[model samples]
Target chain A: MAVLTDADIEALGLTLRLATTVTVLLLLLGLPLAWWLAHTRSRWRRPITAVVALPLVLPPTVLGFYLLMLLGPDGAVGRAMAALGLAALPFTFKGLVVASMLYSLPFVVQPLQNAFEAVGNRPLEVAACLRAGPLDRFFSIALPLALPGVLTAAVLGFAHTVGEFGVVLMIGGNIPGQTRVLSMRIYDHVQAGEYHQANVLSLCLLVVSFAALLAMSLLRTRRHSRD
Target chain B: MTDSPHGLEAKLAWRSGALAFDIDLSLPAQGITALFGPSGAGKTSCLRAIAGLEQHASGRVSFGSDVWQDSSHRVFLPPHRRRIGYVFQEPSLFTHRSVVGNLDFGYRRAGRPVHLDRDGLIDRFGLRPLLERRIDNLSGGERQRVSMVQALLSDPALLLFDEPLSALDGAARSDLMGCLESLHATLKVPMVYVSHNVDEVARLADHLVLMEAGHVVAQGNLQETLTRLDLPPALGEAVGTVIDGQVVDYDAHDQLIALEFVGGRLWLPYRHESVGQRLRCRIGARDVVLTKAPQEGTSALNQLPCRIVAVADADHPSQVLVQLDAGGSTLLARITRRSWHELALSPGSAVWAQVKAVALGL
Candidate 1:
């Protein structure tokens, strides 16, 4: 009984790529959205905040069902993609990236929002008086002060995307070298009574998660001591 | 002191919750103009409006012809766009930056033709040893010094200070006051400072804008405004006289320096100031003693023959305040009810006013 096979290696590699791509995209998109959510006094703040945090409490199947309908050939997004000369997104690597991002949205956004709130407006006001424009102040003062929060958000988003299963199962549909990530592969192995293969893949995920969590705790201690 | 109106000209009307104020002011070109009032008197609001920080306010704010906020023209510049530096009540420094990094932020962002000398300012403000230190680790006074130096390095056109010393202890306040007084002497940019402290206002302000409730009670030259007799009844007890003059002579043996004003002179305890340096000192009304005749056996260093100009009721019923004219200068004397009746003190009554050497605040 082989513990690790060639298919397992490809699945883990795809999982890493998907995790990295999703985490990077979320950071870039979530930063400005989180910043706006933290500081805005507009009437839509509560509604928007609840929407962003919906993924945290909503069952992954609920999100996956809606996403599946939205990405189907006759769906609005699929129509737009076809008009742009592209294929439908379901069961593809790009589709997994998209689904993983939706699953991990709150993991990336909430930490950054909390960090931005902690930084407050006083330092920004002081920067303005010192002749820093809006964008300049954000990059120079707000970002540096919120560095610890940003690091935490990045790690959480990466780990969460790697661990997600339900949403990826619904949209990605277990396509090898495309969307058969480590989590889906482990599920397939267990269903086929390949207990040894499932155990090995499960142990790999457990180690990666443990290492990431350990790194998070160590970074938190270093930040606390510095502060 | 030219005849033309210059420096900051602001006509602002603002309301914050239940408190509201409308102030029309024109401050001078150079030197410190203090916005002095009690808390809730809109002193800080005036400073904020001038700095383009108060958005609720309407009307116009112009610093020496450069309009910062003009509601009429719909021209409202943001803080970074306007060349102004603001120092808050607390030392709101960037906690992420080191002292040197904070200084460099200002030095690099300032536009061309920077007039401030960075090295000399660093030495003057005693920030050499703390260059690499984190802002959070600095003491309150040290942080404030860094905040001020940070503002100065930006080469601002106008500097606004909103009770910068109100957060410090007595000892720290005194030390920072010394630094601020020295900085005021050399600062080329105009300043609008806000404080409720009478002593701080008297020591630092060349001009004063006094406020109460939401109104400007008085605003003019420091000496003229402090000596005005028709001040608001709420400020009756604080009525005194301010004298601005040069140190004409100093007697080291007696530790007294003779200060000459427009039409009179007074001797105060020496504090190691060189001759010919201008001094602005205040004398409380209660410190002036009026005698019918000059006493030779008195230890008081100042005795001037002044004629009674007017007598007004003081805040206390048991005392009366008398105004006197010693040639061209005006002096205030606070005396008891009994003394006023017994001496037959009236207008044109020539009397000798004795001012104690230590009673004058410099």
Candidate 2:
């Protein structure tokens, strides 16, 4: 076992914060997109879905390269921020959050969209007939019914964000307190020949991810058993 | 009941693909108004249009004086604002919520000013035992009951049922129907009910709207509309007469209620009503037997004097419809061709219509 240290605790906390922040952001951005993707009959839906999924197939390094440019001082986002008198985003915790959100977009969207799709038009129509307006129906009927999908998506996004390396290295630049997430910390420990610390952190990640997956499965099983 | 809006009047027109529907109907707002038609004949579509769930091209839907939809003036109140309660074919309960929570959903959405009489609804629907149960744990009948209660909690101005009893088994369907019948009898809200089942329509509907291919083929009092022979055979086969009768006697030993119809006495199974109470009974054509004379030593309990008014094809190889006059009411008898020939049955033939005691739908 690796001896406990303040640095290790800080690294763990930072990783958790990054993962959580990224997951929340992804959920906020992905929910409406998922709803639209599931319900819309637009001709551009398939192509739009493919574009959203492009990052999943592309190399993580390639994604990180574009993100790096996007957040760089002279790049589009960075320049725009600078023009607004704000600091450029690269090499910061916020940059790491942005990179994690991008890399894990599909993790958030696919589950939510699948959940929305599974909810069909029947319930919504029934709700409408029962005198529920569109917004009311979405919150009261659609959101509650799609809860399992939301949990799965959030967990997957959070876990995937914690496991990211290439994107984090490109944009976050391994700052100890700010951007040294768990996966990057494990990579650093391995490179420095500290196998014990790397094993401990890796074990922690494994246990957490496995627990999340188990909880989701148990919830789904309980739902099916009731039905 | 308060003299608040007592009927539904609407002219709904909508087009989807090659299917275009234009319907004009006025239904008495008190009893069950059945939108009877075959599947895809726009029964559900009409219900949806009334509930404001369907956007019609040029339409006007009004309940009594409240205008729900008017496309000419571009006035359309969405479903929620229209205050119409709708129960779908499927229960469509929220699986994530417990039964109580699911029921509370609509109650809450009804806003702060209008509160549901939850205890009353729960008692009426027999939902107390299942109140805390999860929706997934309830049976088909139980789920439907909860859905109905949920809709009722919305305090709707009109209740629209889109084949609410179609998904249940025979026993459950009857149980649910009984509950609905009592609810309709007690509540002042008017209901527009949709069903493809003739038996269901016969049992529940006071008014009938017959639809064919997205058009209102006929609409009137249930007995009059159903007896029309011009409709498709499936509908025509189920065509019968509805008569309002009073329970004159209840023979406890025999488990029968001797009902006094317009013509004569008819015995039915004991129902949950007292003597002198009015009840509706549906007698299908197939259940009546026409005899040239009053027969004796038969188990049948009803033999009323009748004069044959018409004979129509029964759509079967060996059967025919014998329309007769029973006092002031019309009665139809479905008899085999062999029997017709044996009796030499024809229009204006005076015969006794013998009905078995059990065949009357009370």
Candidate 3:
């Protein structure tokens, strides 16, 4: 029977908030882009697909290094924010969110794009003949049909964000109560030789991620059976 | 809305890869008009263009004064703004929704106040028991019926049926045709039906538009247009003439409906309909036998006095089309080489045509 301390609870809460924010942002950004990738007949599709999937192949440290520089006070993103009268974002919670979004983008986009492709053009054409506009078709036809893929993408993005350490360390800088997510907290406890606390935090994250994946798989299975 | 009484008018030109097509057509505001053509003749493409689904084209489509599309003027109304219902060959019902939910989708999206008559549509289509079931559990015919009902719920000004019966088996097709005829009779909305089946066209269409190579070669009343011998070979050897009739009597014990035509009476198998209902029956060209005088004691139930207006050779072996005028209504009799020679069939020959009555499309 392991009891969680106040600090441990805060770390779990921060982790959940970070993962949720990143997942929501990914969905908002990924949906239209995925739709375009799935439907466009342009010759540049291969190049665009390769660019979107670049983060999946590149090491996390490489992405973290570039992102850290770009978000620093003197760099491009930070300079743009300053010009807009906003605060610099490097070494902050916002910076960690940005890092997680970039790291988990493929996890969100691939499944959604595949789902959109699998829906084919026939159903959409039928919807069009039934007097459905583009947006109405998406909400009434596309989104509902692609629900399993959306669920898979959301859970994968959140789980991938939870396990992230390199990008957060590079950009978020492990500040207590601000940027120290559960994964970072676990790393700190391990470095200080606090094995029990590290084990507890690791188990919590493992249980949450595992539960999310299990729920997603179960939902998909049920949908298949119904069909 | 445009006040032009013509329900639909379109002049569309489109290029897909190397295939370029141009079509111009206008449909009257009432009755079922069929677009009859072979596959690859742009039948589905024309329907899609009218529905506002195919956008990469230059066209002028106006339905009853509403400018649907005018690419030259850069005016286009999206599909949602075009009040049309479409039923595809595949049914295409939403798999995620139950039968009731699918029907409600169209009902809700229609938005404006409409006399939907939802219960009546369900009962007419025999969909009451299947309403609560998920779409995945339905048979092919059930799915198509639900699809038709869903389309009707939208209260569309025009309905497009693109081979709605092409995917069904023979029995299902016959059953669905009855439902479609009922819907056509009750609804005031105009319909554009597409099919390559000539028998189906003869049974349902009031007007026929014949397409070949993306062009409408002929268009007129169904009986007149179909009886023409100059039609394309895609129509096959099953060409026939259509006549509208009323059920004069139904002998339930004999399992037949006695239909009253201008020339004579026709007996059809019991079709789930009451006496006095209007019905369309088709007699194929090959089913009639012409005799110089009234035949006595024959197995055929119908022998009507007819005058041979003309005789033309059919493309097939030893067959000639004998055009006849029976009580001011035009009919065609297809006879083989041996029969034509034996009867010495020619123009102005008054004859009695023997019909077996079983070959009628009731």
Highest TM-score among the candidates is held by which one? Answer: 1
Q: Could you tell which candidate, 1 or 3, scores higher by DockQ?
A: 1
Among these predicted structures, which one has the highest DockQ?
1
Q: What share of the true interface contacts does candidate 2 keep?
A: 0.76
Give per-residue lDDT, candidate 3, residue B181: 75
Mark the regions of model 2 whose C-alpha exceeds 4 Å error after superposition.
A1-10, A192-197, A218-227, B1-6, B15-20, B55-58, B111-117, B252-255, B269-273, B296-299, B316-320, B335-349
lDDT of 1 by residue, B263-362 (tens): 6889998987779998877888889999999999998889989999988887788988888888888888889999999999899999999999898866
CA shift at B202, candidate 3, in angstroms?
2.5
lDDT of each: 0.88, 0.84, 0.84
What ordering of candidates by lDDT runs from best to worst? 1, 3, 2
- Residue B355 lDDT in model 1? 94
Alpha-carbon deviation at B80 in model 2, angstroms: 1.1
lDDT tens per residue, model 2, B1-362 = 21235478889898866879998988876777889988888888888888776765468888778887888888898877888888988888888789988787767777723446779889989999998898777999999999999888877878889899888997888899889878867776778889998777877777888997899888888877776655666566567777778899999899899888788778888877689987778888888988899988999988999999988788787878878889878888888989999999888888998988899865
Weakest 10 consecutive residues of candidate 3 chain B by summed lDDT: B1-10
How well does candidate 1 score on lDDT at residue B81?
A: 84
Over B1-362, each residue of candidate 3 has an lDDT whose tens digit, in order, gives 11237678889999766667788888887778899988888888888888877787578999887899998899888777788888987889888789998887777777733577888889999999999999889989999999898888887889989999999987789889889877766768888999988878877787888887877878777888888867766664646768788999999898888988888787877867688888888888888878888878887877889998887778776777778898876888888978888878778888988888677645
Error of 1 at B209 (Å): 0.8
Cα deviation of B326 in candidate 1 (Å)? 3.3
